[model samples]
Target: MNAIAAPAAADDNGLETGLNATLREPISADGTPVLGKTYTVPARHGRAVRVKAGQTIRIANPHGTQVCDTWIFNAEHLNEFLSFEHTRAYIDRIIPQPGDPLVTNHRRPIAELVADTSPGVHDTLMAACDLYRYRNLGVEGYHDNCADNLRLALKAIGLRTREVPQPFNLWMNIPVKPDYSVEWLPPVSKAGDYVDIKAAIDCVVVMSACPQDIIPINALNPLDVEFTVLDPAVSSHS
Candidate 1:
């Protein structure tokens, strides 16, 4: 009888044979995502995106010092979303470091912080700025805010404001005082600084280029932010 050969363990690119297994594509220069495909989240505005598992979403502050309030939702289950309380409890820290997975309200991993070029300054304490908060701050008339931006972002993705949950404030600088109090401050990230995350599950990514000018969280200047979703598994990207 002829002996049978074992199943090939490597593919053309030498990656593991299975798609759900470890990925082979490596990220360099933040994947240098296609420009035309890039979406700009204008200052004080928000945008929604659909990122698949193993793909990455890179948020860049080209002009620098801007805060991008971020939120994530499970694509399969609308009711389950990224939760600040869960993240804090799991990570045991208000802020997460590279390699830390961002969890959902149901305690499922949705995304992970994969890369960071900035000082990794961010906030998870204060809630996204809303109309009510601004009014109390002495602001008059209608104005842009993170809360509204989140609603708009959700709408773009066929969701509602009610689905919006606590966001991970990317690049925000809120210093936790010795007394356990935190103070809003300008971001330590400079121009070209960015952070990239790999989605652990299919997720809807939401972002609001924070419109907050009441404090120095954005250096008192709101700037445009760049959002790019890259699929490392795609050979063309390599």
Candidate 2:
């Protein structure tokens, strides 16, 4: 009888999960935000904030060329997040427009796109970049990525999610060609352009200033973006 060999184990990276500056710089100890105050998500970093139901979050593109990967999760349930696949099915489009309901995996509305000051071009097709992606891109060491940013952002607020769902890639311009090929391009939004998303339930919103300098998705440079949780009583969109 011949002995069978076991399957090879996968390669292991040295970094610990949720280990980064993000954990030390949460918007608040519990992810709650001060109403009407704008916070900056530094380049190559992520930030998480709590937006209560009926509150609107305005994400601003300060440089207009950077891509901010955005995610929303139910405060009570980290697993219940704004799913792009479910949202695409709900909205019947690839990019959501103002007034479209962003849905969750269970087909429930989690948030609504209230207003967009840009041309309304956002990508819902790409997965958040991870360390493995950077490895494939010939990066020899650990690189800051959106997937870990999501994890670190949640962990910063004493929460965790087993899965990283596709994000609503704000200002990420990936255009499909006539032959169905896609082109990774920079955002068309101008400086100070913003979008407002109103929460249907209390939720934690995470945004990462994507650090994909190798590709031109961020015009070969990543920059900080800004966000503010609006005062529901005074917000015009409320």
Off by over 4 Å in 1: 1-36, 233-238
Q: Which tens-of-lDDT digit does each residue in 1-238 have in candidate 1?
A: 1122222443231111112100112122212335236677877777777777877888899888899999887777767878889989998888888889899888878899888889888888788886667778897655577766665565544555444477899999989889988788898999988888888998877788888988888899898898888645542221
The positional error of residue 140 in candidate 2, measured at the CA in angstroms, is 0.6
**lDDT for every model?**
0.73, 0.87
| lDDT tens readout by residue for model 2, 121-188 | 89999999877787789976667788878878888888877777899999999998999999999899
Candidate 2 Cα deviation (angstroms), residue 155: 0.8
Strongest candidate by TM-score: 2
* TM-score to true structure, per model: 0.81, 0.92
Q: Which stretches of candidate 2 lie over 4 Å from their true place?
A: 1-18
- In order of listing, the candidates' clash counts read 0, 0
Per-prediction CA RMSD (Å): 16.5, 6.6
